[model samples]
Target: MVIYGVALLAFCMLVGIILGELLGRLIGIEANIGGIGIAMLLLIFLSNYLKKSFNLGEITERGIHFWSAIYIPIVVAMAAKQNVMGALDGGFIALLAGGIAVFLSFLLIPLLSKLGNK
Candidate 1:
């Protein structure tokens, strides 16, 4: 059932949050870094495995798909809530990092387009 899929997502989210916290602590960051990313990746892999190996029904698939669709909006909202001022206060390094990331993402466009054509 779709409820089962929700439970599965929640479980993955919990584990991802724990793991993210641990990783942050290990790296001396003291923040929950990459938790949602980890959870989404986990959900992708495990849901595929369950669908292929266990023949999960359409309802569960739809439920998982719904959550996946909802995931990005939530992430965007959370990211928007982040302390951009604090990052700027850290120094020019943060701005540099952001610029580099934007440049790299723009660079990826042509590469991804070529790959898609292949």
Candidate 2:
């Protein structure tokens, strides 16, 4: 069932958040770092595992794909929220860092595109 796939994603998200929090604490921070990324990776691995080990129906696969499709936008929204909040508190250093990151990312586009062409 599609619901089953959603349940699996939810389970992975819960586990990922817990692990991320634990990792943050281990590093002496107080946030769920990389939780979304972890959840996405876990979803990928688990879905592949299930596909190989069990006969997941079309509906379930659809459900997983649905969430996967929206995952990026969700991550972007969350990150944007964090960045806005952080930038306000972080001031000049944060703005400078963001600008550098954007510049570097833009600079890498051509190189990355060339690599992809090969």
Candidate 3:
């Protein structure tokens, strides 16, 4: 069952990559990887539903490990690029935005959880 689930996950990702490439070329939206993002979001919801409805085992931790492994090379390549130094010019802005996002999420999650419980 784990093997089957793994295969299915790989297939979904492959399809997402192919579709993303095709759509990016067609629309001239330079290098958009939105399909993979959409695929991941769908997978998250599907896995949650399956786990709650059918008692499938939680595989989120394993999935996170797998994705981290997959993204490491891409991250390394990006960091190696010539413009990497220039990219850090906006580091402070990026940090601020990220901090705000984290703050909002931290504030909202507990409130939302409490509201849901009520």
Candidate 4:
């Protein structure tokens, strides 16, 4: 059962990667990151359906933890790079952009949710 879940996850990721690459290439965008984003979105939807259909409570939580554990070190290593500090020299702009993004999401999510309900 666990192996089946793993296999299904891998298959979904591969499909998402392929689809993202095709779409990105057609649009002249970078495929690797786009592929990952598409893969993640597809994985989320598929996981929800699989959990409901299979009664696999907390499967998503497990997957989240697993991925986080796998990626945390990679992220930390990237952040540790000397160039990362230099990149953050535009700290004020970064903060402003971050704040704007947060503010927009705060306003947008509720409005979007309401619209979705309609």
Worst 10 residues of 2 by lDDT: 79-88
Question: Which candidate comes out best when scored by lDDT?
Answer: 1
Backbone clash tally for model 1?
0
Full ranking by TM-score: 2, 1, 4, 3
Candidate 2 whole-model C-alpha lDDT, 0 to 1: 0.86
The all-Cα superposition gives candidate 1 an RMSD in Å to the true structure of 4.8
lDDT of each: 0.87, 0.86, 0.72, 0.73
lDDT of model 3 at residue 40?
81
Best by TM-score: 2
Q: Which digits, one per residue and each the tens of the lDDT, describe model 1 over residues 1-118?
A: 9987678879999989999999999999989999989988998899778877897777877776897799899999999999988988978898899889999999999998999596
Cα RMSD to the true fold for all candidates = 4.8, 4.5, 7.0, 5.0
Give the 10-residue window scoring lowest on summed lDDT in candidate 4: 56-65
Model 2 residue 63 CA deviation (Å) reads: 2.2
**Which stretches in model 3 have alpha-carbon errors above 4 Å?**
29-32, 58-118
Query: Which pairs clash (backbone N, Cα, C closer than 3 Å) in model 4?
Result: none
Model 1: clashing residue pairs? none
Instruction: Write the candidate numbers in order of decreasing lDDT.
Output: 1, 2, 4, 3
Per-candidate count of clashing residue pairs (backbone under 3 Å) = 0, 0, 0, 0
- Scored against the true structure, residue 13 in model 1 reaches a CA lDDT of 95
Residues 1-118, model 3: lDDT tens digits: 4555676577667777777787898988777567887668666787778777886555644654576577878888877876756756768997799789999999998788889595
